[model samples]
Target: MSEKTSASRRAFLRTGLAGGLAAGGAALAAGAARADDPLITDLEAQPWTQYLGDGVDAAPYGLPSEHEAHVVRRNVAWLTADPVSSVNFTPLHELEGIITPNGLCFERHHGGVAQIAPSEWRLMINGLVERQLVFTLGDIMRFPRVTRAHFLECAANSGMEWRGAQLNGVQYTHGMIHNVMYTGVPLRHLLEEAGLKGSAQWLLPEGGDAAGMTRSLPLEKALDDCLIATHMNGERLRPEQGYPARLVVPGWEGNMWVKWIRRIEVGDRPWHHREETSKYTDLMADGTARRFTWEMDVKSVVTNPSPQAPITHGHGPTVLSGIAWSGRGAIREVHVTTDGGINWHQARIEGPSLDKSMHRFVYEFDWDGAPLLVQSRAVDSAGFVQPTKNALRKVRGVNSIYHNNGIQTWAISSEGEAENVEIS
Candidate 1:
């Protein structure tokens, strides 16, 4: 090699080394600046970092962290006469994603939770069938199994807000619902095994609890997407969720999904039980009643920045998140408005868009810390848009307590506190 080429190569190597050293020095200065943050500087001094955690055997069954103890199901004492026959609300504001944790799923009991031995559980198919059939839990599990995700919503959810906004928190007003994946055998497969008689038109599913909660379902719907479920969210059903077995009636109200389900009696006519005639029916202004109202309408609620979950971070870049669902189909879109209904921005829907399941959505914006009114409107695949409270009252007359799917509004102060409010 020539001396001139060697000298140029040596100079290029020296310059490259100097440039690399400068970049390294700049990175070191940035790291020194970040060292001032207490979270980074003191992290090694924390107990969790310095000490070993509990062994795996310490928690035989896993549990939530101590910091998350506040995330729980809550019940309103005045909502019912006694705790046994009351309903509890899910902590919707504290949850994320589309699926609700099994432990935190909202519960509604007419006679409290019934604890039954799986070995003694029996599902009897009687009336209007070629043969009376009784299948044990073991026998039911032997059939072909299927899994599906669905949302179960009580008919009376948000019932208290029919007249006006009475609940201060979204947990109490919109928490009587949960979405979970169920594993079970199709009801049609079981009915086919039992041989449904030609005269069969209706089915009466009775619960094993003391109240013996029973509801009449149409034969067509029963054969469509119903299931005799034994598992939820990949685990055995919880005691409050019906232990041994339960019924799944997709896209329908929760009353029809009988927990601790024991019997299915085929009949030719509807059985106007107390729950159907006196309890679940919607009273109209003309002294009439709307009965057999099964499906839950398209609904959405802003879970975060709610009354219980106030925005404590003050102003700056803010994240607004919520959930929307529909019994008819999937949620196609969700629109959020910060100035009541003056302006609406389409929220980005995240997670899976399953049919008859909850859909999570998020909207990010810069906040000026001004007093604002927050609201969300949902549009479902069926093209049904969520209505306002006053618009719903104009048609339904506020004489009933069931099936209130109106849009909810939360008034936010400059301080970031939120409260339930209805806008005209």
Candidate 2:
């Protein structure tokens, strides 16, 4: 071959090889590349890249990737007497967006998850109602349905932190909450069908679980946004979450969203049940107790860069994300601070800002490898602002466990390790 032809062919081969490497580098960077990472440089030799993967039938019901097994609902074994009657936290740091997955939603049970067949389940409306009635699961489904998204947060969420920073991770500190789209019949429609008596002013919803959990709810609230939820996130309710039926008391504590709900008794007065009187009430420093504190206050937390989720990639272009919510109304704004409240920056609120639902917020900045203190504060549409831990203590006192929506702080070290912390 002539020298000129041979040189042209060699140059073309070199250009083609460089182009391929450049394309592969871009793909690797998108997937979180490492300078000396074998996964990127030897991608073609990886087992999964060369093999035939599982078929469609492998997962009868779709499941998360095997790599995500670490993301799950977890319980602190020391928190309760038994697993059946205890609570498990959602892995908040592992999730994104507003909707919580059915499997990962937090679980709080008084007796344990009830496993009643849908065919055998029933809902009875008794008490002061004009017409006492019992409807089968199928019967309830026949009513006019509405779908709405809301965040159900246990009053005890962050309860452990009322005194100090106790839990090490966001999951345990603030994971007793989940947001999902619910499809169900309005409680007002059901009450009207049963004919509420003129004197009916309260409701006592009872669960079908072994514990038969019950709570007293105001009649006015029931007629407002309460729902007889049958499905969550477009699927039948998970057994841990109320199964065939549950109550959706928008903007209320999780206990009021009675799972395995089987009956609602309309009454002329509050039942002052165990949940409301002894357990869920807020006890004050002066020995006075606060009751009927139903609505969850404005709250926000830095989920990523929390103790469980630290910044793994060092130094530059760090993205911080978290969730904010309020039982009163939609969140109007969320402000983040990187220096323990000394300086605050407005975070960009992303996704739908629905009433009484979770809202995701993000803040991105270039990390300078300095030790940091991160926190987020939320403001709801009703003008309620999330309080600082000290500010909350001033009003509610440290003795109270429920409804503690104080801002949370995470101390980030120079190496990017995060720790749950409290700042004066």
What's the TM-score of every candidate structure?
0.91, 0.91
The reply for model 1, stretches above 4 Å from the true place, is: 1-35
Clash pairs (backbone) in predicted model 2: none
lDDT values for all models: 0.90, 0.90
Give each model's clash number. Answer: 0, 0
Residues 294-338 of candidate 1 have per-residue lDDT tens digits of 999999999988877766555677899999999999999999999
Residue by residue across 333-414, what tens digits does model 2's lDDT show?
Answer: 9999999988999999999989999999999999998999999999999999998989989987899999999999999988
lDDT score, residue 345, model 1?
99
Q: Model 2 Cα displacement at 186 (Å)?
A: 0.4
RMSD of 1: 14.9
